[model samples]
Target: MESFSLLLRGFSVALLPWNLLWAFVGVVLGTVVGILPGIGPALTVALLLPVTYDLEPVSAFIMFAGIYSGAMYGGSTTSILMNTPGESGSMITALEGHEMARAGRASAALATAAIGSFVAGTIGTVGLTLAAPLLARVALTFGPAEYFALMVLGFSTISAVLGETPIRGLVSLFFGLALGLVGIDLQTGEARFTLGLPQLLDGIDVVVVVVGLFAVGETLHVVSRPHHASFITKVRGWTWMTRADWSRSWKPWLRGTVLGFPVGALPTGGVVIPTFLSYWLERRLSKNPEEFGRGAIEGVAGPEAANNAAAAGVLVPLLTLGLPTSATAAILLAAFQQYNLQPGPLLFVTNPSLVWGLIASLYIGNLALLLLNLPLAPLWARLLEIPQPLLYGGILVFATVGTYSLNSSVFDVGLMSVIGVVGYFMRRFDVPVAPAIIGMILGPLAEQQFRRALAISQGEMSVFLTRPLSATVLALAVLVLVIPSLLRLLRARAAHQGRP
Candidate 1:
């Protein structure tokens, strides 16, 4: 009941005239970016970070929330029509959605994708509304030791899950940790990795790193690759779903929401996992499983719902624990820091309006996406027609201008270009950049908590193990790091024993 009242208050804030306009603008921009190949929400939000510096925090975050959810909605259009996933989360959608499009059911495929996204996004938002506060309350009990342990869990889970191999993920994470170590030591008042540059004293800005890696690096990558001709499936026939289509889709929407929210809330959960799980689950539950590869509406419905729901789920830990599970969540964390606000239990108490208002905007955003996407998916699909050179040229200009605007530092622009080159190499090598981003953001916090824990224990190393919660969380982190290697070893041994 208290949550309900607070939500009503949130709605009051979100419905403000200015806030509504920002929400509209954000969703519109997000949909545009999401339709264009290679420009996801992370890059869009990163580019806008500098632009939002003077904006009100509540308004900025509301716009960001709209962009986040709207991108999820828009990615489906690209997946269904062009067979190109605008975001990794939408990759699963391409399998059946493109197939449906090919078979001349483009309208049905798009309709189910849009409607399922609406259902799942709404349900997931409700879950976030109910769950985040509870999680925040629980997190309020944590000590420095517990916080450190929790961050370690985040580090391990992200490093283990993101790349093809855990080694590659850890490599990416270590790179970020190295960057985090560049700034002056807060406690010791000493520079570690400054290399005698004055700008190194304050460290590289998160915004610069984000723009370099996502915008500049992605642009360079796309420019380097040969452009391939893509076939766009035209929307034909009635755009509305038939009665049979509705029956096949509703259950999958509910199930995808059920699977997405909890997984997304977990430290290890991400959109890719839940989306793939939803696809697999839908296949198993389908009465006509064979239709899965051949344009089944269930295939389009389930994964699209899971993709959006999981996007919402990623916000839960981000809000409650200040833990980011995905690259976009990490960037959002940077936005919070730009305003000198920290996400976690205290954020809710200190900034209830911001917290609740942000949540409420999500509801509005989801509704806006449904209404906007259904009627205008064809128009959104036309975005694919944009010339690559023009699109990438604009991104480079925005990225350069955004980086330069941060302190008007010509040096920062150079730094961004250098990092952009590094980012290009990281992508070329298939090293997941998300771990690097998460690491850079969380590394300093982890170090702070670790030192605090030691101080509380009078330099005792056992503090992390002495506290029950800390011990459990640390043990879980270890498992996250170790389990995959153990499983691989077991598989190798089994293969050896079975000797071909």
Candidate 2:
């Protein structure tokens, strides 16, 4: 009942005229960026940060919520039509969505993906509305030791879960930690890795890093590859899903929501794992398993739903614990910092209206995406016709301008180019970019907590293990790191025995 009342109040705030207009603008812009390959929601939001500098925090966040949801919807359009995914989360959708398009069932594929995203997004928002506050309330009991342990869990799981191997992920994470150390030490106010540069005192900006890696690096990668013209299938039939399509899609949608939100709400949740899990589960349960690689509507529906749901789930940590589990979430955390607003237990108490209104806008954003995509998908498909050279050139322009505008510094732009080069090499070597971003964002906070916990314990090393919550969380982190390697060894041994 309390949640219901707060939500109703949130609706009142979101329905304000200016806020509604911002939401519309954000969703439209997000859809456009998501349709263009190599541009994604994080980069889009980072680019728009300069434009939103004057807007009120509530309106700005409402707009960001729309962009976040809209991008997820628009990404599927590219995946289905052109076998290009605007976001990594949409890769699973392309596996079967493009196949459906090739089979002339493009209309059904698009419809199921859009509708499933809407369903999963709505459900995930509800979970957010109910779950975030409860988690925030529970988090009030945590001490510095517990918080440090929790960060350890996040660091361990994020490194292990992403990339081709844990070593690659760890390398990326350590690199980020090293980068995070470049600024002055917060406690002593002493410079650590300034390298005699004035700009290093405040630390490298997250926005600059995001644009460099996502926009510049991705453009370079696309330009390096041989350009192949994409073939888009024309929509030949009704845009609406048929009864048969609905029957096959509904179950996967439900199952995907169930699988996605919980995993995503975790402190270290990333969209990739839940989406893959949802896809594999759907394939295993499917009555016609052979249709998986061929044009299976269930495959497209399930993974798309899981993708959006996980996107929503990322907010759980960001809002309740000030923890960012994904690249976009890390960028959003930077946005919050721009306003000097920390999102955690205090955010709800200090700004309940902003918190609830953002949540309410998510609901509205999901609906707006569905309505916008369903009628205009044919037009959105035309975006694929854009010339690669022109598209990449525009991305470079935005990346440069966004970085320069941060402090009106040309040096920031140069720094961004250097990071872009590093990002390109990271991509070439199959290193996951997300872990580095996460590590850079979380490393300083982890360091602060570690020092605070030690101080509270009078420099006793056992403080971390002496606390029940801290010990348990650290143990869980160790298990997360160890379990995967043990499982791999066991599987290898079993395979060897079977072969003999």
Candidate 3:
């Protein structure tokens, strides 16, 4: 009853005029970003973090949620029409959607993806709403030690799961942490990393870092690639799915949603694992098995739904436990912290309305995306025909304008250029930027909690293991790190002996 009433209040907040407008802006901008190759939600969200400084926290989060959800939907347009995935999640859709397009069934492919996204998105939101309350109640009992243990688990998981090298991930994270520590110390008057640069005193602006890392990094990434748009087959057919399409697609959509949520909630490779699982399922269950790689509707519908559903689902842990399940989630986690809001068990009790409002707005944002995409997909598609040089030039303009508008700080722009150079090199070396952002966002929070926990126990390291829940969580964190290495060693040994 308590949580139920709180949810109603959340609806009230989400419905506010200002929040609604930002929701619209976020969804529209997010979809545009999604349609543009290489400009994903993570990068955009990171870039836009600076703009939210003026927004009410609830409105800021609602906008962020819209961007996150909208990007997932926007990726499909290009995948179906151009055989190009605007976002990584859309890769699965390209397999089948592009095929459907090739068959002159572009409309049906687009419709199935749009409708399936709406259905799965709503279900995922319901899951978040229902699960959050119960999780919050459990979280309310945690002490400093437990909070510290939980944050450690989150940090370790994100650093370990993303990219090829855990060492690089750690290095990236420490760099972010070092950046996070640049401003005046909250606990002490000493400025640690400023090095007498006035801009360093306030810490490297989150906006500057985000815009540079995402927009600039991405632009640099694009210019380095091939100059021409590659040839892709044109789409055809009815602008809607047939009855046959509906019959085959519903069950897979549900299954994809189910499979995606838990994976999205864990500190794993976000949608990657769930997407593979959904694709595997559709392949195994399809009546026309050979039709799959050749462009079956089920192949297009399931993974696209799973991908969006997983994107929505990852928000659960980020909001409820401060655990980011993906690279994007980590950025959103950073956004929450920027507003001085720490998401955890205490969050539900302290800011029920904000959490609930953000969740409710997700349902609205998906509806907004569907409505926006259904009519404007062609416009999005037409964008692809633009020459690469001119297209990238416009992106560079938006990146600069957006960065400059937030604070009118020239230093921020300069910082963006420097980060862009670094980001360019990181991509060349295959060092993932997401883990660095995650480490930057979560490092300070985790470090503080860890020290707080020890302080409470008078520096007794045993306290980390003495509490049942903390010990269990810490033990699991240890297992996630160790089990993989052990398996790899066993495989290496077997290979050395030339055994099958």
| Best-performing candidate as measured by lDDT | 1
In candidate 1, residue 259 scores what lDDT? 92
> Can you list the residue pairs that collide in candidate 1?
none
TM-score of each: 0.98, 0.97, 0.92
Best by TM-score: 1
**Tens digit of per-residue lDDT, candidate 3, span 120-172:** 88888888888777877777788877877776676666666665666666666
List candidate 2 stretches off by more than 4 Å: 237-239, 497-500
> What's the residue-level lDDT of 228 in candidate 3?
71
Computed on alpha carbons, the lDDT of every model, listed in order, comes to: 0.90, 0.88, 0.79
Write model 1 residue lDDT over 365-409, tens digit each, in one string.
989998998888877878888877788888888888988988799
| Order of the predicted models by TM-score, top scorer first | 1, 2, 3
Query: What is the TM-score (0 to 1) of candidate 1?
Result: 0.98
The residue pairs found clashing in candidate 2 are none
Candidate 3 — which residues are off by over 4 angstroms? Answer: 165-168, 232-237, 405-407
Displacement of residue 181 (Cα, Å) in model 3 is 3.1
Q: State the lDDT of candidate 2 residue by residue for 1-500, as single tens digits.
A: 78788988899999999999999988998888888888988888888787788889999999998888888988999998888787888999999999999988898999999999999999999999999989989988888899889888988888898878887888888888888888889999999888999998889888878888888778777777787877777777665788999999999998999899999999869888888999999999999999999989999999999988998999998998888888888778878878889888889889989999999999999999999988888888888888878988888998888999889999899889888888888888989888888888788888999999999899998999989999999999999888888999999999999995
lDDT at 173, model 3 = 68
